[model samples]
Target: MPVHRRPPLPGVQRLARALALTAAATGVIHLGVAPAAATPADPPDRADVKAQVDQLYDEAEQASEKYNAAQEQQKRLQREAGILLTQVAAGQDDLNRLRADLGAVVAAQYRAQGLDPTLRLMLDNDPASYLAGARSLGQATARQNETLRDLRERQRRLDQRRQETAAKLDELEQARHRLAAAKDEVRTRLARARQLLGDLTAAERDRLAYDDDARAARGADRFDLGNEPPASDRAAAALNAAVSKIGSSYVYGSTGPSTFDCSGLMYWAWRQAGVTLPRTSQGQASAGRRVSLAEARPGDLVIFFKDRHHVGMYAGGGVVVHAPHPGARVRYESVSAMPVNSVVRV
Candidate 1:
């Protein structure tokens, strides 16, 4: 049996040299087996699983924010609908009383046995005065007609109020359904993530946690604040406010002085600067003047990912202050830490 050596192709020669350099950089190699044609190594199972879990978590977080927004909307609509229902009930009562009074008036008129009620009243009081003052008879007739017209108008208004209340109730119901769906979606994604993590070994789980911690630590702001000037006074103030919120825990649907989501953090920070931001990151993406990353000021809002679901306020020097996600706290990170969709100056 003869062992034949195959000559390396031009491409293979360069690849072999590159691999040799890489092995040299690492300073470790098999003594006898020359770095032969490099073979692709199997991807690490832990890393692959970790990536899957991360993706699931990211999707869940997105859904969670939407659920929070829907919940807020549902609550607001419910309150409005309740108030409308109360008003409708009150109006219905008023209409019922008015109709009952009108019915009584009609019943009294019917019992009068075809007599002209106004004439009867005049006759009952003073025939001489009734004859001398024809104006009194005319006034009595006008008042009777006006009472019927008023009652009819009030009934129509009450009916309209009922219709409006019904419409608002329908809106409230729709909002409730949306909130429910959003919540379910978040739950489903999180459940799948939990299951995936359960399949991993304890060591793999620890690695995942370490990876997250490493990512957060590596994401520290590398920008010098003094190098980049804010585009506006409000932008500067908003950026400062956002920076002040560093370390506040992230909470879904929260836009506050204590905790916040990505967009919530931006919303609260901008609000502090007298600028109102929208509730969701997608909405905030459109709430300002679009600018290039180069033109972004310290207070500018930076939206990330193609769907624009995440947001952070620029903290100057290529860094941002944002609520990264669930289980994370507000912090300053590199603006380019995530795929940037756009920069907005509010």
Candidate 2:
């Protein structure tokens, strides 16, 4: 049948297209080929990033202190071992001399055919002379016995020294391993911190740095250090030394004219004052007499954190000069900015 149908209207064509799109979507759903739903996610904000970065920096500082402690211990062990080695060498020389003396005495006796002194005296033509010679021989024998005893004692001491040196070497090796491990940990933590910071936008990183500086500045401005005398001349010298390094970079495990860590700053500053503070914050914590924070004076060590892994020099008033952390320079901040562990007057 030749039937001519009218062409569909534009509205009908639009409706037909809509229907086709709906059928296709239905078919996709029925075939389990619909797009997956997007799960909700809350991205980390700037504050969250800052907190994480700070935590990582703190951990890195802790590991850096451990590395410092291990290095110091290794140095001490090496020094002690060297002293022991010197002593052992000297002892060995003495022992050898003693043995030589003993050997000479034995050879003299062997040449005499191991004869009894009284028998030898009886066989000699000049009995009186023989008696005198016998007495001298007896004295020599007594001296040899004493030398033997001395040799035994010296040998014992040399052995002890060797044992001590061996122990020190073992400890030195352990310290080296610990130093390596701490160094690895510090690197790991710092890398993590860098990665976290890297994830942020450049503007966010700038804002973070700006905020940190602003906070430090505000703290410094708020604390007015009155004109108070230092606890001692050494204290004043140390404070001045620390102040001289105000903008030095905070390099982990560095103690110096250029860069420093938390405890490193204290160590170097005190050294400038003719005092040697301990190399680690924990060690420095007990390096001097403890005092109340109220009695804390310039150059006094202000230990922070429950672990005592951080330290700073009191810069009068409530401010402290310290190498704060990685990526920060040595600067002044309020002592109350961190949890105070104790105050040490070194």
Best by TM-score: 2
For residues 1-346, write the lDDT of model 1, one tens digit per residue.
0001212322344466668778774554455545445556533366555555656657776886688678778788888888888888888788788778767766765664366757665566686665555565466558768887887888888788888888888888888888888888877876876787787788888877675555445433444655677888988888888888777777667887898878888888888889887788888889978999988887888988888878888877788878876656777777776888999888
Number of the predicted model whose lDDT against the real structure is largest: 2
In candidate 2, which residue pairs get closer than 3 Å at backbone N, Cα or C atoms, i.e. clash? none
What's the TM-score of every candidate structure?
A: 0.73, 0.82
**Candidate 2 lowest-lDDT run of ten:** 1-10
Task: List candidate 1 segments past 4 Å from native.
Answer: 1-44, 100-127, 132-135, 218-221, 224-226, 256-258
**RMSD, model 2, all Cα superposed?**
15.3
TM-score attained by model 2: 0.82
Residue-by-residue lDDT tens digits, candidate 2, 1-346: 0001212321344456667777777888999997455435434456666666777788899899999999999899899989999999999998998898899889997887478777887788999988777778789889988988888999998999999989889988999999999999999999988988897889999998886665444544667877788899999999999988877788999998898998999999999989988899999999999999999888899999888989999998888989988877788887887889999998
